[model samples]
Target: MTFQPAGATTIAAKTPASETARRNQPLQSFDLLVGPLSFSQATRRGLAFYLLSDGIAVWLATTGLVAQAFVLLGLSRLLAVAFGRLAAGRRSARRGLVAARRPWLEALLYLFTLAVVAAANGTGSFAASLSGFPASQALRVSAATAIDAAVGYLTVQGDGFFRVVTRGLLSLLKGLEAILTLTPWPVLFAVIGFAAWKRGGPMLLAVVWAALGYLGLFGYWAEALQTSALVLASLCVCLVIGIPVGILLAKSPVSRAIASPVLDLMQTMPSFVYLLPAVAFFSIGKPPALIATVIFALPPLVRLTCLGIEQVPLHVREAMQAHGATPLQTLLKAELPLALPSIRTGINQTIMMCLSMVVVAALIGGGGLGYNVLFALQNVQYGEGILAGLGIVFCAVLFDRLAGSGRKGGA
Candidate 1:
C-alpha cells in the first residue's frame, strides 16, 4: 500500500449531514413547468395569415375602400404566407409538408377562395365586394366576335370535313345503339348476366340484374340502351386517341409540354363550355354531344396512360433495349403490359365521367334517359326526373361493371 501526503489518505472521512447532502447535488440550468401548448410554428403562421387577411379585408371593406382592400389583401396575403410553406427539397421532403403545386399559386387560390366564402356566407355583407370582377364590355364583345368569326369560318369552310366526321361518328353511334336496342331483351340480359357473373362473381351478378331490372321495369330499356351506346362510342374514340397520345407524351417531353396545359383546360373548364365548341363545330345534335363527351372524358385516360408508361421500371426498358427490341416492340411487350393496371384505372375513370355527361349530352339533342330527366325538368315533373335520374345511375353502375370490372393487374 502507498501512503498519501498530508491531508490526503486512502480511507474516506465521514461528512456532516449538510455536507453529505450537498456532495453530489447538481446545479440547476432550467426548470420544466408543463401546463399547456400553443400551435406549432407552421400552424401558428397559417392561422395568423388567415386571420389577418380576413380581418384586414373586413376592416378595409368596412372603411369603404373596396378595390383598395382587394389590392392590399393581395399583398398582405403574400406576406402572411411568406413563411407559411415549409422549404421543400430532396432533403426536406416529408409526408404533408411539401406542396404538390407551386406555393404562391396555391396561396393565391386560397386567398381567392377565402374571399369568395366570406362574401357568400349568408348576410355576410361584411365581405360583399370581393366577388365583383366584371370584364370590360368592349373586351368581352371583341372576344365574343372573334370566337363567333372563327366558328363561322370553320362552319363555312370546313363543312365537308365536319360532315364526314359527323357521318362517321353518327354511323358508329347508330350501329351500337341499334345493336343494343334491337337485340332480344332476354339474350341481352343473359349475355350481360353471364359476363357479369364470370367477371365479378355472384355479388356483381346480383347488382347487375337489379340494375337491369330497374331499367326494364321502369320502361327505360330503350333510352338506357341509347345512353349505353353513347358511352361506348365515346369510350371507343377515347381509347383510339388517348392511348396513342399517352404513348407520345411518355416518349416526348415536347408533346407533353404542348398537351398538358390543353389537358388542364379541358378538365378544369365547365362541362357546359365544351358544348359551345361542339355546337359551333358539329352543331346541335347527337354528334356534338358525343364529341363533347369524348373531349371531357379523354383527358383522364391520356393522363393515366402517360403516367403508366412513364412509371415502367428503367431496368425493364433497358433490358428490352439490350434484347434488341424495337421501340414499338418494347412498348407493346413491356411497357403496355406493365402499365395495364393504371390504364385500366384510367378507363374506369373515363367511364364514370362519360356517364356524368348524360344530362349534358341531353342538352345538345343527344337522346337517352337523360332526355327523360331534361323533359321532366322542363315541365317540373319531379317524379319523372327522380326516376330518370335513378335510371342514369343504374346505367352508370352497369357500364362500370361491364367495362371497368376486371383483374387488378388488367387481366
Candidate 2:
C-alpha cells in the first residue's frame, strides 16, 4: 500500500444524495409559475410587450394617429426578433435553455400583432376592404375564361379523334356486356369458382360460392352480371393503359415529372367531374358511363404500378444484370413478379372506385342495381333502397375479397 501525502484531503465519489442535489440545483434556477401568473423570463417579457403595445394603441387612438398602427406593428415585430436573438445568445452562454422552457418573446410579438390590428380596426372590416377592392371579380372572370377556352379548344378540335376512340370503346363495352349477360349462369359460376380456386384457394372459392348464390337467388343475377361486366370492362381498359404508362414512368424520370401532376389531378378531381366530360363527348348511356368510370378509376393502378416497380429491390435488379439477363427478362421474371402485390392493391382500389361510381353512373342511364336504388329513392321505398344498396355492397365486398386474396399469394 502507498502512503498518502501529509496535508492531502481525499475526494469522495458521488452518491445518490449528490445526484439528487444536482437535479435540485437546476430546478432552483427556474422561476416556476402556475395558472394565470408567471415569473419566468419569457412571461415577464411577454407581459412587458402586452402592456407596451396596449399603451401604444391607446396613445395612437387618442391622438388620432391610428393610421400609423401598421408601422408600429412592424417595428414591434423587429424589436421582438432582436430580443429573441439576444435571449437565445444569453441562454446559450449560460446552462442553456432546457426543453421545458419556451420562447416567450416570439409569442409576445404574435399577440401584439393581433391585438394591435383588432384594436385599431376590426379584422373582419380590414379583410372586407381588401375583398371589396374591385379586383376579385376580374380575377375570377379571367380564370373562368382561361378554363373555358382550354376546354373548348380541346373538345372542338379533337372531336373527330374522340369520336373514333369512343366508338371503339363502346364496341368493346357492349361486347363485354353481351358476354357476361348472355352466358349461362352455371357456366359463369363455374368460371368464377375456377378462377377463385386458382388464385385464392378453397376458402376464396367458398366466398365466391356464397356471393354468386346471393345474387342468383335474389333475382339479381342478370343485373349483377351486367354490373360485373361493366366493372371488368373498365378494369381491362385501366390495366391496358395504366400498366404501360406506369412502366414508362418507373423507367424515365422525365415521364414521371410530366405524368405525376396529371395523375394527381385525375385522382383528386370530383367523381361527378368525370361524368360531365363523358356526357359532353358521348351521350348519357352505358358508353359514356363506362368512359366516366374509366377516368375515375384508372389513376390508382398507374400510380401503384409505378410505385411497385420502383420498390423492387435494387440488389435483385443488380443480380439479374450480373447474370446477363436481358432487360425484358429481368422485368418479367423479377420486378413484375415482386411488384404484383402493390399492383393488385391498385387493381383493388380501382375496382372499388368503379363500383362506387355505379350509382352516379346510373344517373346517366347506366343500368344495374344502381337503377333499382334510384327507382326506390324516387318512389320512397326504403326497403327496396336498402335491398338494392345491400346488393351493391355485396358486389363490392365480393370483389374486394377476391382482390385481397392476390395480395396474400403475392407476399
Candidate 3:
C-alpha cells in the first residue's frame, strides 16, 4: 500500500529519534567505593580540617602574620648559615652569608620599610624625622627662597609683563568674588530647578533647598562662601597639576608603576600628618592650609586621569590612528572626551576631599566653617560645633550633588 503524504508525515513523527532513545537509556553507575588512607593522607586531611576551622582566627590574632612569617623564614636561613659555618669550622664565614650584599642598599631599604611601617602604624612623627631628613629640609628651604625671589622679581619688575600678569590675576579673583556673591542664590535656585526638571525631580530639589536654607539659618552664609572659594581654588590647582602628571604617567609604563605606590602613600597618609609638614614648611596660615589641601586632594584626580586615559578602548585608539590623527589631536578629541566622566568623578572626589580637609586645615590657621567648628570644639560650645558641622555637611552635599548631576548631564 502506498502511503499518502499526511500518513507518511505521521509515521515520521511517531518514530523514536536516536537522541530520545539515548536520553531514555542514560543511567550508569560504577561500583561503590570506601576509602582507607595511608598515614600521610590522614595527616593531610587532618591538617586541612584544622586549617579550615582555625585559619581565619589565627590570622586575625597574628594581624601581621605574613610579615612575621617572612621574618621567621629569614631567621631560619640565618640559623642554617650559622650551622653550616660551625660545621665547617669557619665561624667568620657565617657573617659573610648573613651580611647584606650591598650594605648601603640594604640600609636604605631597611630605613624605607621601617619608615613605611611606622607611618602605617601612626607613628608619623618618627617616620617624618627619619624619612624627611636634612636633604628634605634643604630642598624645602631652597624652594621657599626661589618662590620668594620670584615674587620679589614680579613685584619689583613693574614691566608690562608683570603688570599684565598681576592685573590678570587680580581681575580673575575679582570676577570670582563677584560671581560668588551674586550668583550663588540664583545658581542655587537654577540648579534646584534643573534637578527638579531632570531625573530626581522635585524631591531632590527640595532637599537641596532645605540644605541651603539650613546653612543660611545658622548664620553661616559668609563662612560657607569662603569654604566654597577654597574648594574651588583647591580643585583648580589639583586639575592644573594633576592632569599633566596623569598624562605623563599614562604615556610611560615606568612612570606609572613608579608613581602608583607614591600615589598610594600620599592618599593613605593621614590628614593630620599633612598638617605637620605643612606647618613645618609654610607655617600656620591660609596659604599653608591651601597648599596642604591641594596636596591631599590632588592624588585622586591624577590617578583617575591616568586610569581613564588608560581605559580608552584599543579600537577607539586604532580608529583615531586610522584617521591619521596626530597624538595631540587624538588626545584632545578622542581620549579626553572618553575619559571625561572618570575625570569628573575624580574632580568630585577631590572636592569632597577638600571639604574633609577644611576642618584639618583650620587646625593650621585656615579660616571658614572649619575654623568655627574647631573654635566651637575648643570652647566646648555644643550648639556652635553642631551648627558649624551641619554647615559643612550642607556645603559638601550641595557641591557633591551639583558635581554628580553635572556628570550625569554630561553623560
TM-score for predicted model 2 compared with the true structure:
0.72
Query: Cα miss at 314, model 3 (Å)?
Result: 0.9
Candidate 1 lDDT, tens digit per residue, 1-411?
A: 955455343223566655533432321111001101333333322444355456767875786645456665655455434333333233125432222222343356556655554454425545454445545999989998998998899899999999999999999999999888889999999999988888888778888899999999999999999999999999999999999999999999999999999999999989999999899889888999999999999999999999999999999999999999999999999999999988999999999999999999999999999899999999999999999999999998887877774542222
Query: How many steric overlaps does candidate 1 have?
Result: 0
Clashing pairs in model 3? Answer: none
lDDT of 2: 0.76
lDDT of 2 by residue, 44-124 (tens): 434554555556656766766456664665565556556665665577457532322244655466556655555545456
TM-scores for all candidates: the values are: 0.72, 0.72, 0.58
- Highest lDDT: give the candidate number: 1
The lDDT per prediction is: 0.79, 0.76, 0.67
State in Å the error of residue 103, model 2: 4.7
Comparing 2 and 3 on TM-score, the stronger one: 2
Model 1 whole-model lDDT (C-alpha atoms): 0.79
Pairs with backbone N, CA or C atoms under 3 Å apart (clashes), candidate 2: none
Off by over 4 Å in 2: 1-109, 116-127, 130-135, 197-203, 406-411
RMSD (Cα, Å) of model 2: 9.8
**Candidate achieving higher TM-score, 1 or 3:** 1
